[model samples]
Structures are given as structure tokens and as C-alpha cells.
Target: MTNDDLQFTDDRPITTQAQDLLDRAGFAQRLALAVSSWKNQESLVISLTGGWGSGKTSIKNMTLDHLAAVQGCQVIEFNPWQWAGQDSLSSAFFAEISRVIQREDPSDDDRKLAKLLRSYSRRLNTGASLADGTAKLLPILLASTLATSLLGTLAQGAVAQITWLGVAGASALGSLSLILQRSGAWLGRWAGNLDEDAKDSALTLSQLREKLQKLLSTRDKPLLVVLDDLDRLSAEQMKGIFQLVKAHMDFANVVFLLLFQRETVEQGLWKAGFDGADYLEKIIQVPFSVPAIASSQLENLLFKRLDEILAQEPQLQQRFEQDYWSRVFQRGMRPFFSNLRHVYRYSSTLAFHCRLLRGTEVAEVNAVDLFALECLRIFAPETYTELSKHKALLTGSDPYSRQDEPQRVRTTQLMDQLVSLAPVPHQAATRQLLQEMFPTLDWVFNNTNYDQGIQLRWLVNSRVCCDEVFDRYFEMSIPEQDVPNSLLHELGRRITEPEPFTILLTSQAEDRQAEILQRLIGLVEEFPLDQSVEVVRTLLHAGERVGRKISFTNWSPRQQVTRLLRIYLQRFEQEADRSQSVINAFALTPGLVVVEQLLGADHALRRKGDVGYFDDSGLEQLKSVYMRKLREKADSDPDAFLADGDQASYLYDLNSYSEGGDEGRRWVEANVTSPDRFLQFAQGQVSVRTTHCGGTTTRTSYIPVSSLESFLGLERWTQWAARLDSLELAEDQCRTLALVKEALAQSEQSVTAEESNR
Candidate 1:
């Protein structure tokens, strides 16, 4: 393969590689057209615009290559930024062009150019030359004469003084003109003879123009001068180069492909006195924009390239799975793989890791894995810092809305982290964590109205986190006094969680276990309402298995039940209203049974002279009565009992009533057979009541059963029963049942086996 076909493996210069690719890619036709347009004296400037990685430089190099090889075009490519000082930019440009001409064509023309350059060099080196210095200064003499005449014309009887002043001015001008003219002439004469170093130093605006004009006049074929790396140049130097091309070389038969970033070029031109568009029009005869390859196409390109590498190194082929390649391409290439440069960097890093694993048990590289690894290496530090920064930004807000804060902060932090982590070497554990966290963060940020701007500010501040360990630690570590208990609480919460959890665990298994229970408890407390009981149960189980004592000190079983029941009721009511198939299934299950059971008891107790007692045969009738009372209560005043204190007190009273004895357990068991039944019972109990005759009197009733069963599932119910059985016989079981009822009322889903069994 030619150099052009070979992607860069390192940071070496790519001039040769770029040119080869240009030839192979069949870009010669367009290149020649560009050259011809210049030779025809159509336009002096052309812009080679491309997206981040579209081979703009390669095209420029191709034009330069063609000029150097087949076209006999003398091309001088100068990147102004490479030169430190811009004091003599014009001279330096001329010098570079002269060198290129000689380098490309070293014959009779070269000889002529060489002789002229020698004279120029000599003149530049020395103060005087073979020509009489006084005679050579004729332009100054003419200027002085003109000045004297002008002065004499303006004033009478001041001839001598005016003459003297004019003479002085003319002499100064003459000397300046002589120096400039000689410099131009010498540059023209030796335009092709200068070495790279000399060319670099001798480039000047005038000299560059002279060389271009001379090359156009003398060269047989079309000439192309590719001014590349203009983006690297300082604002002033770029402006100067552009001005020289526009003002002096406009009519020359030389095509100048000025390579630069669009933004940089526009900005530079704007900073100069010229109107960007107008100035561009004057110089750029043709403009072409290079767009990024479509994501699908780019992925194909990566696969094709990887296939070639795999073919060459068969052993390396086995390391990666087919899906791995796709994953890596999707993950890394989607966001920032805009150019060949990015492709090269990504591939090279993969190759580097592949090489490291060669000749060992380590097989072919998993592209996705490698990509993630590389991302971590490149981005983890930055991500970590950004997270900290965003956290800080969030901390700065006063009376922050708890609902809005963490999501916003975490999303911003994750985005910044993902961007940073993208270019690192792979570490499986870290990569997995990042993948899970980043996408979650992305979803939150996009779907919700998080403070994106503050997040960005925090991200900018996070640059410091990318430093080495010492720097990162120094920058992110919090002070002892200022550290909030909530922060520790959050971290602990993460440690105990499983998949979809954000806790980062250390490699030491024992260590992970040691603090896990505490973390789990903290997380349960921190996110009790947001997290499912199943999650809390799993955490508790995991902690217990590792010999940790699980505590629900802040976890109110009644409150949890109440929350679950409410959620279930809302869902069931909505489904029932819609008359969905799910509702039919729900009606047949424990939901209808539970609702009927509670409502029956409530009605019997309320009935005049009717004892609230029922035999086995009257169970159905009793349940219907309870259900009716619940419906009545609900229809009475829905909002009155929803108040915080009222609900809490009601839940507490229900807990007490349920602890009355075997009656409570029997009541809960009858009601909570499924999620739906638990919800109905809980909703019935919590619904407020008012007098039927429209009187303003209100009564708060504590329904005996809690809906915890729905929230904790069957397993938790068994566990709570076992625990209660261990405590006080029937009373604890009753209380446990009541709590379960309350939990089921408030939750959206069932809890885990461990919580139920506990």
C-alpha cells in the first residue's frame, strides 16, 4: 500500500502520505482544475474548507505533490505559525518560494534563479553592493526633488530651507526605495536558489509576490502554491499573508490553496480591516466545503480498516468479537470521529493495546472494550473532575430544590465525564460503570429541565480533575468541616446498589462487603420514596449475607406501605376507568378480595344494631360492606385526608389497630392477595369521610390494614410475619400485616423476597 493508504500510526508529518492518497483517490482531476484556474489568471485564492477531519491538508498536499512531480509547478507551502516572529513575514515567504522552485527544478531556470538569489543574499548580508550606492538611491533623490518643488511652490523666499527639508525627505525615501527594489530584484533573481532555512527567513510580502509573478512567467506548466497550516498562524501573520496575496498576487497565474479552519480564517479576516465575505470573494475564486462522513459510513470505514489489520495479523483477529467492533465504533466514533485524524488516533490506540497483548494468552482486541478502555484513559480524569465541579456548582445554590438538583448536577457531570473518558485505555470495570452512568445521565438531562448552563460551567471548572493523581486528589478532596453528611450518605447508598446503581465499588471483595450494609441502609433512607422496596430489600439481603446488620431506623414500614398503596390505586383506577384487560385480571385477583374484605367490616361496624362479626359463610357479605364504606369514604372528601400530618397519623393509627390481634392478620391476609387488592384496601382505608347529609363534619378513620404487602411482595410478607412471630405472638403479626397494607398502598411495584421474608 502507498503511504496515502496507510493511516498515520503516530504524530509524524503526513505530507507524503497525504499526496499519495490524493493520487489514488482520483483527486488529481479537481487538483489540476484548481491549478489551471490559477494558470489562467482567474483567481489568486481558493479555500479548502472541510469539517474537522475531512482530508483538507491531504488535498492541499496532493496539489503540492502534483506541482512538484508531474506538473513542474514550483510550490512553496508555508505554515506561518511555525515561524516564531512575524517581523519579516514577507521576506520569509519569498525565501520559501525560492527554495521550492530550486528544489523542484534545478536546470537552466534554476541556475538563473540561483544567480539572482546569490546577489540578493550578498546585498542583504552586506551594507553596500557592486552598484554605486549613491546612484542606486535614485528613487530617494526623485522623492527629494518632488518634495523640494512642492515646498517651493507653497512658500516664497524659503527655497533653501524648503530645499534642504525636501532633500532630506527625498534622500530618506530614495534609500528606502533602493533597499526595497534591490531586495525585490535579488529575490526575483535567486527566487529558486534559496535553501529551506534561507527561504524561511527571507519570505516577505514583496518578495513572495515577486516570486509568484516570476514563477508564473517562467514556468511551462501551471503553478500551485499551497499555503497550508494557516490555522496555526497568529492573527497578525495570517492577515499579512492574506493581504499580500490579495493586493499583489491577484493577477498572477498562480493558484493559492489557503488551508485553514473556517472559523479561524473568518475571525482573522474580520480582525483585519477587510469585510470577511468581500475579502474572501476577492481572493477565493472557488470554495468547497468538506463535510464529515455519515456515521454509518464512518463505522463501515472503521470496520474495513480493522479488517485489513486483522488480515495482516491473523492472531490479532481472534481477540475481538464481531459485536465488539460494532460497539466500539458506535461508542467512540459517533460523538467525535469527524476526521481521519480521529480515526488514526482511535485505531492506533487500539493497535497499541493489541500489540501489548500479543504472543500471550490475551487474544484479539475487543474493539468496544478497547475503545472504552481508551476512553477511560483519555476521559476518566476529566469526567471525575467535572462531576466534582458540577457538585460544587449545585452546592452553591441557595434553598435548592432537591428534586431538581441531583439530576441536573449528575447529568452535567456525566456528560463532561463521558467526553473525557472517551479517549482512554480500557479498563473493563470502569468502562462498564461509565457506560451505564453516561447513558442514564444523558436520558435525565435530555428529558428533564436541568440547569445545563451551570453544568457546563462546572465542566469547565473540572479541567483540573484531569491532572495526575496528586493533582486530582488535591483538587477534589473536600475539607473535613465542610463535608456534608448527605454526601457520605449518597456515596454509601451507591456502594450497596446493584445494576443501574451508580455506586463504584473497589476491587477488594472483603472491603466492598464491610461497608456495603451501611451504604445500603443509607441509600434506603436517602432514596426510600424514589427507590423500589425490591431494591432496598436486595441491598439489605446483600448486606446481611456479608455479615452486616441491616437497620430500617429511618424507614417507616407504615409510610412505605401507604406510598405503595397510593401508587397501585392510581394505576388500578386508571386501568379500571379505561376498562383495560389488565383491570379484569386485577378484579379476579386478591385486589377485589382485599377491597371487599375491608369495606365489609367497615359497613357492618357502622350499621345500626348490627354487630361487626361475621361467620365463614358471611365473609363475602362482610367484604362487600367494607368495600362500600371505602367507596363512600372516597366519594366524600378525597383531598381532606391527603394532608401530610393527617395521612401520617392515620397510617400510625392503622398500624396500631392492625396490631389488635389475629383479626388483623386475618383481615390483611384476606385483602392483600395481589397488587391490585392491596391497593384497593389501602386506598379505601386512606380515603377521607364526611357526613352523607352534606354537613361540614369530618371524621378521620384508621383502616386496620396497611398495604405493605403490595410493596414488599409475598416474600417480604413472610419475612415480616416470621419477624413478628419472633417478637410477640398475634399482636406483632397484626402490626406487621397492617404495615404491609400501608406499604402496598403507597408503592408502584412489589418488593423483593428478602424484605417479605425478613
Candidate 2:
């Protein structure tokens, strides 16, 4: 068949095997004989059972399809699960059978008979109106009609004998009995609502037996019942179905054919109170298992199906190779033949992808490549990143210090230094440092399988390289036009200010550790900085141990060190409260100039009662005084200061600027000395805004500062102007009055000199 034909057939129900097995004529003959014998004697029960995807439903349909040719026998089909949870199970069951009987034979009398029977069943079950129940003697009416017909023939001088009359009466009774029994059997098949009352009724095995007996009389035809999709029911529901069937085993000439996946059915039964094998023997009169098809046969089937699909769309035929079809078939179709649902799902997915690839340059699809792509889609970026990090750590070189190897001391020292920056416990810090330095080397140490380790190592190495690329992209100060197409570039565009790496590095003193931190911060900010704060904290905690000790004697280097200390302390203070450990760490640094500068600024601002108006020089002087006081305290008694009663209060007073109107603006202008400096400070405090009187007394304020035009150079003015314009305040307002005053003074001096020369 062509591919198009295969696609079309995929939409149709599968019926070729069933039709082939039971040739139409032979099946019809067998059905008629079965129905005839069942009507004559009700002691037989028939069940049709098969595994999922087997033809249980199809066979049942086929049996009913030929029932028209049978004499004195009727066919009725009832699906119990459909009647689930309704109170009157018996009434519903009888109602369905009555409808079916009326439809099969629709004479006026037949319709009346069906209506009477249905009403009778409802009255019996629900204690409802009894008019219909009284009319249920229609079967007796039918028997009397036959008796009258027989007597009428005798009255016409045919000389009918009494023995003949008895035989006829008996035959009529048999037919009526069969009809009534079927109607009753159908009623019993209803899965009664499992309310408290129904639950109690369910436990009464005798009631079920009596109902079953009334429905399936001993002289009636054995009923064939097929239960499909049993796996769809919950364990309790499944148990209910089984219990119902078992309870009525003696009353009905009924055969139950249960269909489901073997494992699902067994598991469900186990959950519902019976052991697997025993439950199967009790409920499933015959269990048929579906075997997995051979890999080659599955391949053939797939190819056949594909051919049919491509027949309508002939262009698709050339898109796949013979081997490709075989591989896909083996991977998706060879696992479980009983699970037709999975088979269809997998095949459909493959077909869809194949259809998508049709007419492309690539002639064949790789199953492994497709599978990997699917897996990647299912997993997330974070998972991949973590896996890569772990791989790098496992395969990388040792990072821990080795006491025996003195020659490796420098490397060990470097490792130790890196580890000290991380805040995690010693072992974790060491591993993290090693991961950063030689990411892929950890896999070797991990003892993973060679292929897995190598693959993981590749991913790890790739991630590390990507991180480095981002760092370099950020580090290089290029014209906005020259920005590299990298993750850092994307991150920079997202942030209104400079990259976090740029901020971290430029905001503090230049040092090796600071530079590393700048890079790390940039990467973290790109994804989610808050989420990665723990990692950054770990790094910083580790790095603190290796830095040089602060000293006041060497003022130049000491100032730089002090600045770094201030930056760290400010960051810690901003991010977290002044914990004893953090405060102690700050006190350990030798120079208090930086800390003093910050505290003095706070005090000066408080003294002025207006933080917004304090100039840069004034703030700097305050910081110096605060730093000096901090140094004095630390020198006098560092341990005592850490445990001091006023430590928290002092830190609070130092950090806190008065919250008066325009205080934030005053602080910005006071602390920032130059245009560039002011801009940086402004960018940091951009979010500062104050409102009063619920919008009635609102005012916008900004710090006034001037740039050193010569220092910026003519070429840089445009960039500076752009930066200035981006601020929340007006561009003209940021120009300081002091600079204008200085310019006027210079102009006056120039005029005086010119006049004298003249």
C-alpha cells in the first residue's frame, strides 16, 4: 500500500485480522446455533476475554451483527461501567435491554411489552408506581394468545388434541421465560451506585444471586458479556466490577470477557484486596496475553504504514532511509504490543517529525539525535548548567592543599586563597574553587563511566568557556556599537546601568580577588543574582582569609586596601544586618579611614539636619573622622568592641542618614565630588524619590555637580551627555553653581589682564 493509503487506514478502525479469522458465513452459522441452544437451556455462560488491543469488542460486534438470522433468540449488549453510580442499577439495566428488544422487533405489541417490562423493573427496584408492574403480565398475555390461536384452529374442525395443546403451551411458556430472563439479566448487570445503601447491598451476596437468577433463567440462552478497558477504572471500581460478577455467578448464564493490560490489571487487583494470580483465576475465566512483535516484523509494519502515508504525499517517500524506519520501529514499537496506545503515540510522533523533514536536503533522520533533542527539551537550562558544573569538578585537577608535596605549595596556596573567598564549609569551598579553575577535571576523579564522564566533561568545559567569554565581553570597554553578541551583552542591555561586573570592579579598588568577583557577579546578574547570592557569599567568605592585612603606615596602598574594606563592609551592611561575625571582620582591618569617612558623613549630615545639601568635601571629611574613631576603638580593644553594647547602635547611626525631605538628594550631592563620580552615585541612588501630603506637596530634586571638561576630552562629551540625560533629573539641573561661579571668576581675571595689557 502507498504511504497515503497507510495514513488513511490509520484513521480507520482495525478489523482485518478478525474478519480473516471468522469468515462471515461460518461466524453467522455458529452464532445462530449458540443463540438457539442458549434460549432452550439457560445453564450456559459465555465470556470473551483478551489482552488490550486484542479483538474482544470487534468479536462481540460481529456476533451481534449476525443475530438477525437466528430464530427465537434475542441479542442484547450491556456495558456496566456506563451505568456507574446511579441508584437504580436493576432498572437502568432492564431499561437498556427493553429499548434494544423494542428496536430489534418493533411491532405495536412488542413496544407495549418493552414499555411494561421497563416500568415493572423500575417499580421493583425503586418502589415506584406499580401500573407498569401490573401490566408486566403481557408475557402471560402472549402465552394466552398462542393458546387461543391453537384452540381457534381446533374450533375450525382441525381436531387438535389435548396433548398437542400441552406441547404448544409449553413452547409458548419457554419463549416468554427466555424474554423475561434476558430482561432481568440485563437489570442485574447495572453497576449500582456505591452509596451507603448500595455498599450494604453489594455485600449481600444472596441479593445479587437472586437478581441474577431472575435475569438469566436456567432455560434462557447464555449471555456473552465483554468488559473492555478495565484499566480505566480505579482500583475500587475494578474491585466492585469483579465482586458483582462473582456474586451473581450462579444466577446468570453469563460470560464475562475482561480486557486490559496484564500488569495494570494485576496491579489493580493486588491493590483491591486479592493477590495477583489468584484474582486473575477468579475473575478472568480465560486470560490471553499479547506478545511483543518481532523487531523485523515491527519494522516491516512501520515501513508498510509509512509507504501508505507517503502514497498521498509521494514527496515524503524519499525523505527516510530503509534503515531509519527499522531503527525507529525497533526503538518505539518493540517494547510492549499489549500497549496499543503507546504504539500509536510513538508512531504518530515519528510520522509527524518525518513529515516535517520531508523534501529537506537531509535524506535520513537519526533516531538517537531525535531522542537527545527531545530529552534536552524536557530538561531545563539550570539542570544542564548544574550537570556541567559537577562534571567539571569531577574531572578537574586537585584543588586542596597537599602537605607532603612542598613543591606544589604555590598552587595549593592559590587554591586555598580561592577557597577562602567562598563562604561554604572548607571541603565544599575547596571543591567549588577546583571547579572554577579546572572544571572538567572532576569527572576523572568521580570514577564515572568513560563515555558519560567524557560527555559531561565536554559540557562542563563548554560552560566554563562560555562564562569566560561573557567576562571578557564585559571587561573590555568598547563603544556600544562594538559590544560582542554574548550573554553579557544581553545582560547589559537588560540592565539600565552598566553591567554588574563593571559596577563591582569600578566601584571598588582594583585587586585580583575583586576582579574575579566582578566576573562572578556579572554572570550571576545575567540569570538571577538573588538566587545565586549564596554562591557569591560562599566565594567571598573563602577569599577573606587570603587578602593582605590592612596597615596605616603605608598610606597609599593602605588607602586602597581601606577602600576595598569599605566597599565590602558597605555591601555586607546593605545586604544584611551587622552580625557579630561581619562586624568583627570589619574591625579586624587596620585602617579605619574608610569606615570613618562613611560614619563622619552620616554624622555631618545629621548635624546639618539635611543630608541632601552636604557637599562632597564635607562628606569626605566626615568619613575620615568616622574611620579614625573606628580605628581608635579597634586598637584599644577589638574583642571588646565586637561585644560592645553600642555596636549595633553605632553601625545603625553610621549607616542611617536623616530621613528629612530631600535628604537622599543632599547625600548624593555631598558624597559625589566630580561629574563622573556624581553620575555613578546618581545611578546607584536612582530609585530615591520622596512624596508628601498624598501628592499635594510633591517635589523632584537632584544633586548639582560639574564635570572637568578637559579631563573628559571633547570626544567623550557625547557619551557623557547621553549618560547625564538618562538620569531622572533634568540634564540642565545637574550642572553645579560652584563651577559656574569658578568660570565667572576666571573670566574676570582674563578681562583684567587684557585691560592692563592695552
Model 1 lDDT per residue over 156-183, tens place: 5666777667666766677677677766
RMSD of 2: 25.2
Best candidate according to TM-score? 1
Off by over 4 Å in 1: 1-8, 11-24, 36-43, 84-86, 103-107, 113-218, 250-252, 291-297, 304-333, 350-370, 376-381, 384-758
Q: Identify the runs in model 2 with alpha carbons over 4 angstroms from their true place.
A: 1-74, 106-120, 127-223, 247-256, 261-297, 309-333, 336-340, 359-758
User: What does the lDDT come to for candidate 1?
Assistant: 0.46
Q: TM-score of each candidate?
A: 0.40, 0.34
TM-score of 2: 0.34
